[model samples]
Target: MSHFIKQNDPSDLFFPGGLFLNSDTFPTSFFSLFPSSSSSSKASTVSCFSWGPTSRTKVVSVFSVIGGGGGGDFLSLSLSFNSRSNEDHQKHGRESRENVEQHEKKKVCEEEEKENNNVGLVSHGSGAINMTKHLWAGAVAAMVSRTFVAPLERLKLEYIVRGEQRNLFELIQAIATSQGLKGFWKGNFVNILRTAPFKAINFYAYDTYRNKLTRMMGNEESTNFERFVAGAAAGITATLLCLPMDTIRTVMVAPGGEALGGIVGALRHVIKTEGFFSLYKGLVPSIISMAPSGAVFYGVYDILKTAYLHSPEGMKRIEHMKEEDQGLNALEQLELGPFRTLLYGAIAGCCSEAATYPFEVIRRQLQMQVSTTRMNAMATCVKIVEQGGVPALYAGLTPSLLQVLPSAAISYLVYEFMKIVLKVESS
Candidate 1:
C-alpha cells in the first residue's frame, strides 16, 4: 500500500490584505457555525470567518443584514469546498442552470396568463356587437324581400285557398275593388312581424349549429350534408316558435274574409273563436314542408357556391375583384363580377318551393279554416284530392315560384353584402 501526504498552504488561510495571518489565529468561537467532517478519505476544506470579539455588537448587526435580521447573534459564515470527480461537478452545475431556467419560465407564464385574461374580456364585448349586427342584417333582409313580393304572395294565397285561377292583373283588380290599393299589402304588417324574428333566429341558429358541428367533426369546411341538416334544424325551430304568427298572417291575407283590425286583433279573435291550438292548426304540414324545403335550399346554395368558387373562371374573376376590392369577405368574393350567385339563389328557391308546393296548399287550407272547419292535415289533403284531384294540391305553384325566386335572391344578396360591409366597418 502507498501512503500520500496532505499539504496545507498558509496563504489559503489569509485574506487578500493579510487580515488573518494564519488559520490557528482565526476566531475559534464561531467554528461551531461550520460543519466539520472527519472522513479524510473524502478530501474537503472548511473556512470560517467572523467579526472580532471586540466588535461583537457590530458583528451582530452585520449578521442581521446577511441572515434576514432574525436574531442578535454575532456574524458568522462558513464556506466548504469538497473534492469530487469531474462528472459529479458537471452534474451539479447542470442542475443549478436548470433550476434558474425553470424559475424564469414560470415568471413568463404568469405574465402571459394575465394578458390572455384581458384579451378574453375584449373578445366577449366584440362578440356581443357582432351578434347584434347579424340580427339587424337578417331582420332587414326579410322585411325588404317580403315587401317586394307582397302582392304576388297575396295572390298566391288566394289561389291556394279559393282555387281562383285569375291572372295577376285580375287578382290585383279584385283586391283593389274589394279592399282598395291598401289590399296589395293585406297582411304585410303581420308578415313582417312574423318573418323578421323568424329569419333572424334562423340565420343565427344555423351559424351556431354549423360552427359547433364543424368543431365536433374536426373539419374546417362543412359538407353540403352538414349545411342541409343545420338549415333544416334552424327552419324547424323557427317555424315551430313562430307558427301562431304565420297562421294569423295567412288568415288575414285570405281573400273574402272579414277584415281583422290588426295583428293584436287577429290574434285575439283567433284565440277567442277557435281556442289557442287553432293558432298552430297546420303545424305538422308546415314543418314537413319547411324542413325539407330549408334543407334543399341550403344544400343547393352551398353546392352551387362551392362549385362556382372551384371553377377556373370564378377563381380568376375573384382574384381580379380582390385586386379592386380588398375589403371583400369570403362570401362577397363569391358574389363578385357575375350574376351567378343570383341565378343560383333563384334556382334553389324554385327547387325548394316546387318540391313543397303541395304542402303549402295544405297548410294554407288548414289555416284558412281555423275559424270555420277544424280539419287535420290528412283530412285537408284528402278533401283537396277528392275535389280537384292531385293538381289542386299545386294550385298556386306559378305565383309561388315567381314570388319566391326573386325574394330568395334579393334576401341572400342583401344579407351577404350587409355582413361584409359591417365587418369592414368594424375592422
Candidate 2:
C-alpha cells in the first residue's frame, strides 16, 4: 500500500505515516506537557475521543487522519482527542490551593479563640483576688487605728453623753481616778467587731459603685460629684447592715451605761429589755450623719490625694523620699510617706466630723434612752437645742476631733501601706 501526502489549502499540512495536521500547534504543546504512554495508546486505539467545555472548564481538541490508497480506491480513518485548556487547569489548581489556605487560617483562628478564653478566665480570677485583698486591708486598718484611739473614743463618748465640758486633762484624771486605765478600753472589743465589717463593706461597696459609675460614664476617671455619691451610698449601705453592732457599741461605751459583760451580753441585754428593734435605736440619725460624713470624708480625701500626687511640691517630696529609700518606686514612696498622707487624712476627717457632729450627739442620746423615752430625730434635736442651747450639740467636739483626726490618718496610712505590700507580695 502506498501513501500520498497532501497539503489542505495553505492552513492544513501533511506529515509522514499517513498523518494529516493543522497549523495550530497548541495540541502538540499540550501532548508534550501530558504525554500518554505508547502501550496505553496502542491498547485503546479505537480512535474516537470526545470532550466539550463546561461552565467550569474549557476544552482543546486535536485532529488527524490515517489512510491507505490503491489506484483510485482509498480507505481512511480519522482520530480526535480532547484535552483541557491550560487556563482551565491553572484555574482549578488555584482553587485547590485557596481551599487549603482557608483551612489553615481557620485552624489559626480557633487557636487564638482558645487563648483569648483562657486569658479572660485568668483576668476574672485576678480581679476577684484583688477585691478580696482590698477588703481585708481596709478591715485590718480600721481595727488597728480604732484600737489605737480607743481611749480617746471612750472619753469623747463620755463627754457627749453626760453633757460634760471638762478639759481633756480633767477628763483623763476623772477616768483614771474613777475606773483606772482599764476604763479607756472598756468597749474596745465591740468597737473592733463593729468596725471591721463596717469598714470592709464601706470600702468594697465604694469601690464597686465607683467602678460601675466609671464604666457607665465611659470614663477612666470619676468626677468629684460621682465620688461623693458613691461614698454616701457606701456609707448608707454599711450603716444599715451594721446598725445593731453600732448601737450596742454606743450603748456600752456611753457614760454611766450599765455593765453588760461583753458584746454578746450587751446584745442580749438590749434584745431582752428593749426588743429587737431597739438594737437599731439611732439608725435614722446614724444614717443622716454617716451619709454626708462619708461623702465629705471620701470626697476630700480623694481630691487631696490626687492634688498631692500631681503637685510640684508633692512630686519633689516623693522624689526626695525615693532617693532616701533607694529601694522604693515612685508609687511606693507616695504610699509610704506617713506624714503627708496623715495630714490630708486628718483634714478630711476633721471636715467630715464638723459637718456631722450634732447628729452624733443626737444619735448618742437616742441610743442611751429606753424605747419608751426614745424620741424621733427631729424631737431629739429640738430637746437638745432647748435644754443646752445650740452649742450643747457640739459638747464633745474637741475630743471627737482629737479622736477622729489621728484615727483617720492612721487608718488611711495603714490601709495604703498594707495594699502596697499585698500587691508586691502577690506579684
Candidate 3:
C-alpha cells in the first residue's frame, strides 16, 4: 500500500491521494520518540499507560523520519505498534473475569428465593415477554432493511415488470427520466405496509416452528437442517398473511399499473374487478420460491452462528459474554456479534437470492397480471426464456443483488441487537 506513492524531485514531496508539496529544503531532524541511541549514553525508553480503556499504548519500534544518511533516504517513514506484555494481558483478563465464587453464591441465593416465592410462573411470564421482544426486533429490523434498500428494490421491480434489457445504470436512468428521482421509491409505502407484518411474523414464526420441530424430533436442541425447515415454514406463513400488499406494491411500479391508483385504490380495484382471490395471483410460485429462499437465508445464518460457536476463535469471542443462560437455547445463548452477524447474513442472503431468483421473477410477472387468463409458473418460465433467452429469467437480478447484501446484513444485526436491548429470553 505504501509502495505506490512516488516523489518527482528533491524540491517536491508526495503524499497519498495525489497530494504534492513543494519545498526548497527539508528539516533534517524532528523531535525524537526515543532519544538518539548513539549520541546519548542513557537512551529514553518508551512507556505507555496500562489501565482500563487507555491500556496498550506501547511502542514496538520506531524509525527516524530523517535518517543519518540524509539526502540518500528522503522522507524515511517509521511504523510502530502498541503491544502489552504477556503478564499485563494475563492480569487484565483475570481482573475482568466474573468472580465465580461470588456468582455461584448469588445464583444459589436467587434460586432459593425463587423457589420460596413461587417464581416458577416467572418462567412463563418471561417467555411471553420474550415473544413481544421478538416481535419488536423483527419489526425494526424489517423496516430498517426495507427502507435502506428501497431504491434498488423499486428499480428491480421496474426491471422485472418492464422486461427492460437495460443495464443497472440504464434502468435507474429510465426511472429517473420518466418519474423523476422519487420513482426510485415508487410503491415503497405498500412495501413497508407489508414488511412490518411480514418480517414480524417471519421472525417469530421461525422461532416457534423451530421449537415445535425440535420437540417433535425429541431433541433438546435444533440442528441446522431443522432451522432450514422452520425458516421455510415461517416464510410461507409470512407470505400468506402479507402477500396482498406485496402484489399491490409490485403493480404500482409496473408499466400501466398507475391506472390502479395508489395502494388502497389498487387493492380495491383488484378485488372489485378480478375478485378477492386475484389478490394472490402468484401464490403458488411465491410459496415454492420462499421455501428455498427463507430456508437458505435463515438457515445459513443459524448454521454460521452454530459453526462459529464451535470454532476456537468463536469460543474466545464468547469468553467475554456472561455465562448465565440469558438466551433461549445453546444457539441463542451464543452470538456472532454485530460484524460477524452482518457478514454471515450477507452470505446467506446471496445464496438464498441466487438460488430462488427465477421463482421470484416468475412470481412478480404473475402478480402484475390483471387478466382473467394468466400464466402458470412453468408457462411463465417458458415465456420469459422465449422472450430474452435463459438470462432474461434473471433480468432484475443485478438490483436485487445490490439491495440484498446490506438488507440481510443490517436486518440480522439490528434484529439481534434489538433482541438484546429488549431483554429477550435465553435458555
Candidate 4:
C-alpha cells in the first residue's frame, strides 16, 4: 500500500572540524556547554546514551532533536544514563519485569514481520493463515476444474476400467443412446467430493514441500528440479491421504458400479464385502503413478511458466503492464494473464497424462479389484497386456488427455484468480 516518491530539497546542515563521539564513554554533563534557552539565543544540545556493557550487550543511542524552545529558535539536547548503584537493590525486581516485557515485545514484533513476509507457500516466509488460503484456493480450483470436465472424466474412467473395445465416437453414442445426456455426469457429485480434497492436499503438500526444500537449499528461488520433487512428494502424500475417496470414486464411475449408490452407500458396500482395508485398494500403483504424474504435471507448468516469463513475448507483456502502472514489482510481473496461465497448465497436464497414462490405467484397474479378485500392480499390468496387447495399457489415453488438459488449465486459472481475490500474491 505504500509507494516511494523522490523529493528534491535545497536545505542542508553541516558540521565543522568533524563531530566525533565514542561509544565506550560519554561526559555526564552536556548542559555545561550552553545556558538555558530563556537566558540566550544560543542553541542547546541534548544527547541520550544507553550503556549495557556489563551484560554483554551492545550500547545503543536513541535521541530526538526539537529546535526552538520559547520565543527563540534553539536546538535542545539531553543526556542521561540509567546506571543505578549495586547497593540499591530495592527496584531490581521491577527492573527485571520491565526487561522481560521489553524482550517479549521485541520478539513479537519480529515474529509478526516473519509471518507476513510473503503469501503462503508462494512467499519467502509462510504462516498458518497464508497456508490456509492456499488450501482454500486449491480446493476451489479442483472443484471447478473437475466439474467442467465431468463428462470427459466419466468417459475416461469407463475406457480405463472396461478395456478398449469401442472408439471415442461409438462410446459417446452408446452413452447417449442408453442413458441420455444426463448420464455423462452420473457420479459427478461423488467426483467433486473426491476431487476437492485430493487437490487441496495436492496443492497444500506441494507448497509445504517446496517451501521446505527452498529453505534447506538456501535458494532464492525454486528450481525446476525442486518443483518436480515437491510435486512428486505432493502427489504421493495426497494420493495416500485420499485413497478411500479415490477408490470409491473409481468404482462409482465405472460401468456396473453405478448401482453402488451415493458416497455413503458405496462406503458401506466396499467395507462390508471387501473389509475395511479395501478402501485403500490400489495404493501401490497410486503412489507409483502419481509420483511421476505429479512431477510432470507441476514441473512442466513451472518450467514453462519460467521460460515464458523470461521470453521476449512475456517480457513485453510485463513491460506493457508496467508502463501502464499495473505492475508494482518483479513478483507481480511473474503472474500470467488468464489465457497464458491456462495454456501453460494445459500443456503440463497433457504431457503428464501422456507420459504416465499406462500407470494410471494400471492404478485404476487395481482399484477395480475387490477382495475376491485381488491383483498386484505387476499382475494388473500383465493382465492388461494379455487382454489387448501393449496398447491396452494406454486405453482411454485420448479421453484422459481431453479431461486433464482443460481440467489442469482451469485448475491453475481458478487458483490464480482465487489468489487475487484472496489478496495473496502469486510467486
TM-score-best of 2 and 3: 2
TM-scores for all predictions: 0.72, 0.71, 0.67, 0.69
* Model 3 ranges with Cα > 4 A deviation: 1-128, 323-334
Ordered list by TM-score, greatest first: 1, 2, 4, 3
The per-candidate count of clashes, in order, stands at 0, 0, 5, 3
Q: Which stretches of candidate 2 lie above 4 Å from their native place? A: 1-113, 165-167, 211-215, 218-221, 254-259, 273-275, 317-326, 329-332, 424-427
Per-residue CA lDDT of candidate 4, range 184-219, in tens? 887888888888989988987887888789889999
- Model 3 score (lDDT): 0.77
Report the C-alpha lDDT of model 1 over 1-427, residue by residue, as the tens digit: 0121111454444334222223243454544454445332221234334443322221212111011121111222343333343345556668878989999999999999999989998888888888888877778878998999888887787788677878877887888999897787877878889998888777766776766777788897888778888878878988888899998887666653456776777788889989998898889998998899888877788788878778997788767776868765556564533276678878888888998889888888888884556778999899999999999998888888989999888777766666666662231
**What's the distance in Å from true for residue 414, model 4?**
1.0
What lDDT does model 2 reach?
Answer: 0.77
Q: Which ten residues in a row have the lowest lDDT in candidate 1?
A: 62-71
Candidate 1 is scored at a TM of: 0.72
